[model samples]
Target: MGEEVHGPLAQTPTPSAGMQKIVTKHSFFCLKGKWKRGRHVVVVRIRSDRMCPQKFVFTVGVVAFTIAITLGGQVLADRFELANGETIEGTLLNPNERPRRVWLVRSSDGTSLQFDADAVTHVTRETPVQKEFHKIVSEYPDTIEGQWKLAEWCQEKKLEKERHDILEHMLELDPDHVEARRLLGYSRIDGKWHKREQLMAERGYSRYRGTWKTAQEIELSDRAEQTEVAQKNWIVRLKKLRMLVDKPQSSDSAAKEIREISDRHAVGALMLGISKEPAFRVRSWYLESLSRIATQEAFSAIVQIAIDHPDPETRLSATERLIVLGPHQAASYAVASLASEDSARINRAAEVLGRLGVSSAVDSLVNVLITVHTAVVSDGNSEGSTNATFTPSGGGLSMGGGAKRIKVESKNEAVLAALVKLTSVNFEWNPTAWRSWMATRQSPADCDFRRD
Candidate 1:
């Protein structure tokens, strides 16, 4: 009977009656009877009418075998090769070459294959499998995705030129790809390119672009959902702010956002924003924002930043903000900060204290003046200049000195200026009272009570 096997798992048919059985023995043979030199082996032959079915069976077997062999070879060839986001397999080829190549051999069937050096983009031949996996994972940073994948892979694989070409092509395909935006942002920030963050923030696909959008949302929303989406949006903005503020290069767009957010939400968001920023200018901007908003909740944090920040400019800015927000409370902190070792900080504190017209600071102001006088006199005489020559007998000495001298005339003049500012706020230092106190002390030739 004729028979056919069609499907992949179909079995071969048994032989027909026409087939004859022939047995031949070399070294070994199955024996129902023992064979000797004179013995004859029995063979069976049968005639069959259906010859076509037998022929078809033989043909199907040959075709199945060929197909199996072909499939096996393809599987082997695929072993050494990997598509995008796939893992490496089989024996590695030339690892030290510019583009790494690898070989694959099928275990089931002996078939050898070769992979192109460039195709092995992400696999690292240097380290163990686990470490290499981590390295590859790190190669794909959060900001890099889409068209730059090839370039990123090339870069990770140390194919510099290939990476450049891939990046160029990525720009061609999508000019505003997120990966391109991220790389450009990093390069611009590193190069100190002006408005790097602003440019990135303006780009819709940039990683930090979400921050700008979220900031706008927060500004407009009277009540934002505290759900994951809102929190994630805020976190993105916070990260952008951190990036611009913590790095040496500042982003003006980030600064502007911070100022706007702080002005709108001075209580918690502004404080949180300021806490995240490490750069002095960013912190200064944040403090100024707090001043503009001027809420009761931010008063303490502003004072703390004024007192604790290492940068004098930042501290001065914080102090100024605090003064604008709450003049009465800020005056105390300003007066205390005037005793700081940092001269700039002390000067700033003194200026703010004078501006605020804190009567309580008069005693501290007098102490600062005395300390300044002692220091000036101690240093002035060492330069072989008599204090009297600089001080006029009846008339007050000029407050200006050099360029700064033009800014202020004398130590006594600065003190007088402070006194005038204080007196303008109805807290006066009686010149006669200071003169009377001077008279109680022994007067040196350099000392002039008249100027006092």
Candidate 2:
């Protein structure tokens, strides 16, 4: 599973004619009922049926051993930190063969060691590539154009997160950037809002889907399981929600009733209820109803929900609804969330901004990139300073990743991608490069955020 990838068939050489026949037979009939292309196999011959079974097990064992030799190696290169202030870097193996209380992690150069929760500080896999990227960004934090080129390259290659971070950096360098703002979904037509379909018709160009939820997704599989309101009167539902927000004992019932309501005046009623709803739960439900209604007025009501709601979840729901309605203007809702302090909310905001690629988020994102990390070393220490220049080994602009995570590393990674996406620049991971870039923009582009 380490960097040294070994193909399954790497060890097994092309079988001889006699062996090939048995292998072909084993592949087609013994293993799978039908022959599959590119499947590998090995075969052995036996003189008698009694000897054949014993030899068969022996042959399988031999094949397994061969594979082990091909894939496994004693070259341990993983790094481990100990509680005793000792650091070791070597190949670490976890043989999950037998149940043993004391697990062993041997070093590459014939050094034996064991892990204990209290004794080990940390363990990490060797990622030369990541280290290299870190180095490059650290070196040219001021080379705004170079980072921008890398960001654009990442964008072209569909490296969404990486591209995003590069753009964010570019924005940090040049906030009023037309291309970055446009790419980031900060579209404005004569100071009016525009969405995905407003500028681009190609669904392929869109990062995410318009329909966050399909028809099947909205429908309740078992409506019978819904909480019984125990009240059939529509007016009573309205009265319950017109109460305190934190004290929402009756709002749940009110929401359930409002959700099921389907009449010509339902939208009007919901909108009115949203405006008057004192309970946050009921207000959240009103927004839900508006979303379900899916009308022009519904969008307006959702926006109102975003503006008026105190609950973060309610505002987030409003944001998602607005984005689904018009992603071109998703940045409209996203910028507000980016300004929030909650980590979960900030992460969601970052995602929304990532898709928008709007340059409007540059300042906020730069603030995040510079501020949000836990410094490995504190200030006032010369050794802790990050001002030293660096150069990537075997210099070549390259960045890519598969699925994303949301840990501290992943959060910073997301921010980096966002900076790239917003500014169409690859600061790689240099806040200083971004700051330098930002300081140079005098006559800014017309990409500053404004709402209708």
Q: Which is the leading candidate under TM-score?
A: 1
Q: Which structure among the candidates has the greatest lDDT?
A: 2
Instruction: Kindly report which residue stretches of model 2 are placed more than 4 angstroms away from their true locations once superposed.
Output: 1-288, 291-320, 324-333, 372-411, 438-452
TM match of model 2 to true structure:
0.25
RMSD of each predicted structure: 23.6, 33.5
lDDT of 1 by residue, 274-296 (tens): 66666666666667666766666
- Provide the TM-score for each candidate, comma-separated: 0.28, 0.25
lDDT of 2 by residue, 148-263 (tens): 66666556656565466666556667776677767777677787545555455433332224543333443532232232232234345555544432366755664566665554
Off by over 4 Å in 1: 1-105, 108-259, 263-288, 292-324, 342-345, 372-416, 423-452
Error of 1 at 375 (Å): 7.8
**Model 1 lDDT on a 0 to 1 scale:** 0.45
Q: How high is the CA lDDT of each candidate model?
A: 0.45, 0.48
Query: What's the distance in Å from true for residue 294, model 2?
Result: 8.9
Model 2's alpha-carbon lDDT is: 0.48
